[model samples]
Target chain A: MSTSIVPSERAADRGALAAPLDDGPRQREARAGRRRSATRIALGGALPILLIALWYAATAFDWVPAHKLPSPDAVIVAGIDLWERGLLGMHITISVQRVLLGFAIGAAAGLVIGAIVGLSRFADGVLAPTVGAVRAVPSLAWVPLLILYLGFGEDSKVTLVAIGALFPVYTTVAGALRHVDPHLVEMGRAYGYTRSRLLLTVQLPAVIPAIISGLRLALAQAWLFLVAAELVGSTMGLGFLLIESQGNLRYDRLFLAILALGVIGKTTDALIGIGERALLKRWG
Target chain B: MSLSQRTTTLESPALPVSLRGVGRSFGSGRKELPTTVLRDVDLDVTAGEIVALIGPSGCGKSTLLRQISGLDTPTAGSITIDDRSIAPADQRCAMAFQEPRLLPWRTAARNVQLGLARGLDRARGAERVAELLELVHLSHARDQRPREISGGMAQRVSLARALARGPGVLLLDEPFGALDALTRLSMQDLLVDIHAAEPTTIVFVTHDVDEALILADRVVLLGSEPDLPGATIRRVISVPGSRPRDRADAELGELRAELLDGLGVPSHHSHH
Candidate 1:
C-alpha cells in the first residue's frame, strides 16, 4: 500500500507543482514521506544496536568470565590475526565456492523436475509422493548415509547442500503452477497460444515471484547444510575454523568464526532479497 | 471494388459465422448430474456484422461466444465460419473476456503483442501493436503495466490486443462490464470507432439493454420463460441505423423497451 500511495501522491504533487500556485504543500508532502521512511528505518535498527551494546558491556566488564566470553575487541583482534595469517580469506573462499556449486546443481534439477511435475498430472501422481517422503527427512540426516557411500570428501558435503536446496524450489514451483489464475490461462488459449507457449509466457512469468522466494529459502538451506557438513568432516571452512578454535579454548577465535558465519549468512540472504525486490517491482 | 481495393480488404476479410442448432451442456459423467446451459439455438452473423447477445444471468451468452471463438465446443451442435468447421488453431478469431485478463507481468504494449504471436514477423507485430494501441486511444499507456493504469485504460489495452491479430471474427464477452458508467460509455464509443476503422464480424455479449441498442446491428436476446430448462434465442431485434448515433434517439428508446419486454423484465423509464 505504501508503494500504491506514494506514486499517485507524487504524481498529483508533480502536476500541482506544474501550475502557477504555491508549492508549499507539495514540498511538505515530499518531506513527510522522507521523514516517515527515515523514522521506520531507525526503528527497525534499534533492537540490533541495543543487543550489541549489551554484549559489549557484558564482555568488557567481565560480567561473564573472559575465558567463557571474549570481549568484542578480542574477537576483532582474532579476526585481524587470521587475516594477517591469510587463513580468513582462504576459509571464506572455500565456503563460498562450495555453496555456489551445490546451489547451482540443486536449482537446475529443481527447475526441470518441478516444471514437469507441475504441468503433468501423471508425473505429479507418480513422482510427488516419493519426493515428498525423501524431502520430509531432515537434510542433515543424509550426511551420515552420504558419507558412508561417498566418503568424507567434498562430494558428500556438496551433495548434502544440493539435497537441502532442491526441495524448497521444487515445492514452490509446483504450488505456484497449481495456483495460477484460471482467467489468464483462458486468455492465453483464446489468443491461440499452444501448450508450450502458454507455459513459457504466462505460467512461468506468474510463478516468478513465488520462485524467487523459494530460491532464497533454498539458498539459506544450502548454507546451513554446508556448515553442518564442514563441522562433521572437513579440514578447511568456516565450520572447521569454529571447531578448531573451540578445541584450542581460544574463545576469541571461536567468537570470530561465529561472527563471520552470521555476517556471511546475512549478506547472501540480503543479496537474494535485493534480487527478489527487483523482480517483484516488475512482475509481483 | 477495384482489384487493388479488393486485395487490400482480403488480407483481413470479415468472415461470416453461422450456428446450427447450437447447444451446450456440462457435467455428464460419473458422480455428476447433467445441466444444460443452451438449447437448440440457431443464428447467423453476416460478414462485417456486429451482433450483441443480451440476457440475464444463467442465459449462456458467454458460453455461446466461447463456442464461436473455438475456445469451447458445442455438446450437441455445430458452429462454422465461412461455412467451414471451426478449428482450435484458427487465427481468424480473437476474443476479449469480461475481465481484461492482461498478463500482469507484461506492459500494456507487450500484452497486446501477445495477440500477434502466431504469424506476423517481429517488425510487423510491433508496428501493428502500435497501430492498435493508437486505435484504442492507449498510445500513452504503451509501457505502463496493467496495475499502474485505470480500469478503463486496461480494458482499452485488451481491446487493442484483440485487434492486433487482425481477427476477422472479434468476439467480446461483456468487455465493458467492469468499468464505471462514464468509462463504460466512453469505452462503448471507442469500441464503435475501432469497429469502423477495422471492420470485423463481431459477436458481443452484454447484460445492458442500452449497450446492445447502441452498438449492435442486431440484438439477440438469449433467455426464456421461468419454467424453461435452457436458454435459446428468445428474439433477435434489428437496430435500424448507422452506429455512432445519439443514444437518446427515439427509435433506440422504443427498441430498448421492446427488448426489455422480450427478456421478461418490465421497462420502467418514462418517455420524454
Candidate 2:
C-alpha cells in the first residue's frame, strides 16, 4: 500500500513541475525564484513557532517551575498589566527618544570631525591617534565617567548613548572619506571646486553608501548604550523595568521586558534597512 | 540652426597660450634625488589652433598638458594664456582626462553642469547644460548615470562638461584613448566639428600618430634625447589640412609614417 501511494505522489509532483516549465524559461525561473523565497520565509518562521510551542507545552505539562520560566501567556498578561497602568508606553517612548536624540547629536559631530581628519593630513596626524585610543575603550567603561561628569539624570544617560553612537560613524566616515577615488577628487579640483565646495559636491556624494552604513551601525550602538544607561541608574525605561521586575521576583514581567527590547531593536534595524535601500537606489 | 552653430554663440573667444622654459621634476626633497619629467619645454599655441602632443609612453606629454591647464605648475618656467600669467586651477582653461571621470551618482546633464561658470543664474546654467548635451549628441542620454552609459557615451559627456566651461583653451589628455577603434574615429571627427564651431584653442595629448595627423593643425613631438635627463619638444610638424580632412589622404599617410618613425616605431611603409 505504501509503495503504491509513493508512485502516485511522485507522478503528481512531476506533473505540477512540468506545468510551469511549459510557460517558457523566464516565466518558469520567475516562478521558481518566488517559490524559493516563500520557502525561505516559511523556514525562517518555523523555528520561532516551534520554540513558542515548546514553551507552552513545558509550562502546561509542569515540566519547568513557573518561578524560573514563565509561560508565553503569562508574559503577555504581564505586558497587558503594564499597559493598563500606562507604564509600558511611557517606557518605550522614553527609550526611543533617548536613542534618537543621542544618535542625531553623535552623528553630526562625527561627520564634521571625520571630514576634518579625512581631508587634512595635519588634522589626521594630530587627532587620529587620540581618537583611536578613545575608541578602544569599551562601551560600558564610558558609563562611570559619563555618570561622574554629567550626573545620573537624563544628561548622563543621553551622553552615554551619544558616546556609543559616535565611534562607529567617526571611524567609517573618516576611513571612507580618505579612500574616495583620487581621480574624481582631481577632476573636482580641475573644475574649480576647492575647500568646502569640493567636500560637499564630490567627497560626500562619493561616500554616501559608506555614510549610510555608518549611520546604521551608529543607530544600533545608540540602542545598546540606551539600555546600558537605563540599566545602571534609570528610574524608568525598559531597562528599568528589567531591574524592577527582578527585584520584585516577577519573572513574567522580566521576560516581557526582554521580549519588548528584542522586538523594538529588530523593528528599528528593519526601518534603517528600508532607508538604506531607498538611499542606495538613489546614490549607489 | 545646427547644434554647433547655435551653441557657438555662447562660447568665449579663444585665447593664445605661450610657454617659456617650462619644466617639471619630482622629489626635490633634501634627502632624495630629483627626477625630471620635462625640462626646458617651450611652445606657442595660437588662438583657435588645434595642436597635438604625441610621444612614447611615460614621455611627459600629459605633464605638459597639465602645466598648460594650470593643474600642475612647471618647476622652471612661465606659462601665459592671453598674456595673463597662469595660476593654479586657472579659469582660462578646462581639461578632460583620458578617463571620463564622471561622478557615478550624477546624470549626464548634471555632470555637464559641473563645468558651468560659478554663480551663473539657474536658468542659464540649465540651458547651457542642455546645449552641451545636444552638441555631443547625448541628449538622449542626458538623464542617464555614468555607469548606465557605454565608454564612448561617457567620454562624450566628459567632453560636453569641459566644453560647458566656455574655456579660453581646452586641454585633453588622451580623452579617447579608452574607446574602441571605430568609436575613436567618430570621436576624432566630432572633436573636429566642435573645433570648427567654437574655435577654442585646443591642446591634446595622443599616442596615435594617425589621430594626430587627422585632428591637429600642428603635431608637436616630445621625446627624451639620448643624454638628456627629461623629455622635451623634439619635432614639430605642420599638418597641411583643413577641417574634415580625409583620413586616407596620401600626405596624411606620409606624415603619419614620419611621426611613427620619430616615436621610434618602424612604419612598415617602404621608401621609394
Candidate 3:
C-alpha cells in the first residue's frame, strides 16, 4: 500500500501519544538506537566465540576423549584435505542437484494442485482429506517404502525429498488463495469480469506473497529430506560422507561434513530471502 | 465512439429510469426477520436530468439507487428503464460508489479501460482511456497505480471508468463522501462539468444538503423513520434556473434551508 498523508499523519499522532509525556529529541533517539544495536551485535557475537573457546579449552586440557570430539584445528585440517582431494565439491554438487530437482517437482505439483483445490469446492472435498492423511505420515516414513518401489537409486532419494516438500507448499498456498480479499472479488464483478478472468487477474496476484513464502518452506524441507534419503545406500553426497567418516572413526571429517551441511543450508535460505525481497518489491 | 458501442443496446430512446412503488427488504426466510429498507418509493428521472437523493443516514437513499441500477432488486414493485425491466448484469446503468473501489494492482489508465464493453479494439480502447483520464484531469496519473494517487484523484478515475461505457443512466452513491472539504467541492464542480459534457440521466445519492441544491435539477428527500416499515419519499423539490448556477445564489440558499427543514433540522440562517 501507498502511505498517504492522512493515514501517516494519524500514525504519527498515535506514536506520539504512545511515547512518554516528554519525548527525546530526534538526534538523541537516532544515536540511542545505533548504540542499542551495537550492544546487541556485540552480545550476539560473544556466545559463538565463547563456545569455540570452550571447545578449544576442552581439547587443550584433554577434558574429553580426543576420539569423541575433534579439535577445531583438526576439523579445519580435515576440511582443507577434502577440498584438496576435490571430493568436497563433488559431494556438494550432487546434494545440491538432488535438492533442486526434488524441490522443483514438488513445488510445481503443489502450485497446480493448490490452485485446483483452492478454487473448486468439489476438488477440495474429494482430494483434501486424502492429502491430509498422507501428509500426516512422516517424511522419513516414506523412505523405505519408496526405495522398495523405485529401488535404492537417485529416483528413491528424489521421491523422498519431493514428498517432504509437497505438503507445506500445498497447504500454505491453498490457504492463501482461499482467504483472498472478498472486496477485490466484488470489485472484479463490478468491472464485469468473468469468473476465470477474476481468478487470474485479481486472486492470483493477491496470493503471490503467500506462494513465495510456501516455496521457501518447501525448499528447506526438501533439503532436510535429501539428507535423510541419502542415509540409505547412497554412494556420494554430504550424507554419504557423514556416514563414511563415522564408520572410519574420523571425527574431524565428520565434523567437517556436518559444518558444510549447516553452511549450505544457511546460504540457500539467504538466497531465497533475497528472492522474496525482490518479488515483494516488484509485486507487493 | 463507434468502436465503444455498449454491449447491450437499450431498447428505448435515451432511456429515462422509472421506479414505481418500489420497496426493498433484506433477510427474508423461515428463520430470519425481513427488514424493509425502502417502501413505496416512486421516482421518475427523465433523460438528462440530474436528480440528487438526499436524506439522513439509513433513510434508504442508497438502497433505492441500487434497486434502480439492478444491483439489487426491490421486493415489492418493479423498476424499469425506458419502460423495460433491466438485469443485474446490464451495462445501461453504470455506478460509482462512495469509495473509489479501483483495483489496487491496475494502473489508473488500465482501470479506466475496464469500463469499455466487449467489441472495442486495443487502439480505440487506449484512445478512449486517454480521453477519459484527460477529462478527469488525471492524464499525468494514467500510469500510476491506485495506491500512488490521492483519494480525490482515485475518485476521479472511478468516475471516468463509470462514464467510459457510455451508459444511458449513471448512478452515484455519495461519490465524494470520502474526500476532504476542498476536494469535495472541486469534485462536485467536476460532476457538473462531466454532466454538461455528456448528458446522461443521473441519480446521485448524498447526505450533503447544499451539495444536493448545487448540482441537481431536483432534490429528493427520504425521511428517516426508524420504526416504520421503510423510508418513503418525503419530498421532491425542483431546483430552478440553468446550468452553472452561482454557488452563492439566494434561491439555492433558500432551497437548502427548506430541504434541511424537511429532515427535521431547522436552519439558523432561515430563522434570522
Highest lDDT model number: 2
Candidate 1, residues B181-245: lDDT per residue as tens digits?
99999999988998888889999999999999999999999896568678899899999899897
Pairs that clash in candidate 2: none
Judged by lDDT against the true structure, how good is candidate 1? 0.88
Query: Comparing 2 and 3 by TM-score, which wins?
Result: 2
By lDDT rank, best first, the candidates go 2, 1, 3
Question: Model 3 Cα displacement at A177 (Å)?
Answer: 2.5
Interface RMSD (Å) of candidate 1: 1.4
Model 3: residues with Cα > 4 Å off, grouped in runs: A1-64, A83-86, A121-130, B1-14, B82-84, B224-227, B269-272
DockQ-based ranking: 2, 1, 3
Instruction: Give the C-alpha miss distance for residue B264 in model 2, angstroms.
Output: 0.7
True contacts kept of 1: 0.75
Worst 10 residues of 2 chain A by lDDT: A1-10
Q: How close is candidate 2 to the true structure, as a TM-score?
A: 0.91
Candidate ranking under TM-score, highest first, comes to 2, 1, 3
Give per-residue CA lDDT, model 3, range A246-266, as digits (tens).
799899988888888988988
- Could you report the DockQ of all the candidates, in the order they appear? 0.55, 0.66, 0.23
Q: Candidate 1 falls in which docking quality class? A: medium
Which candidate would rank higher by DockQ, 2 or 3? 2
User: Pick by TM-score: which candidate is best?
Assistant: 2
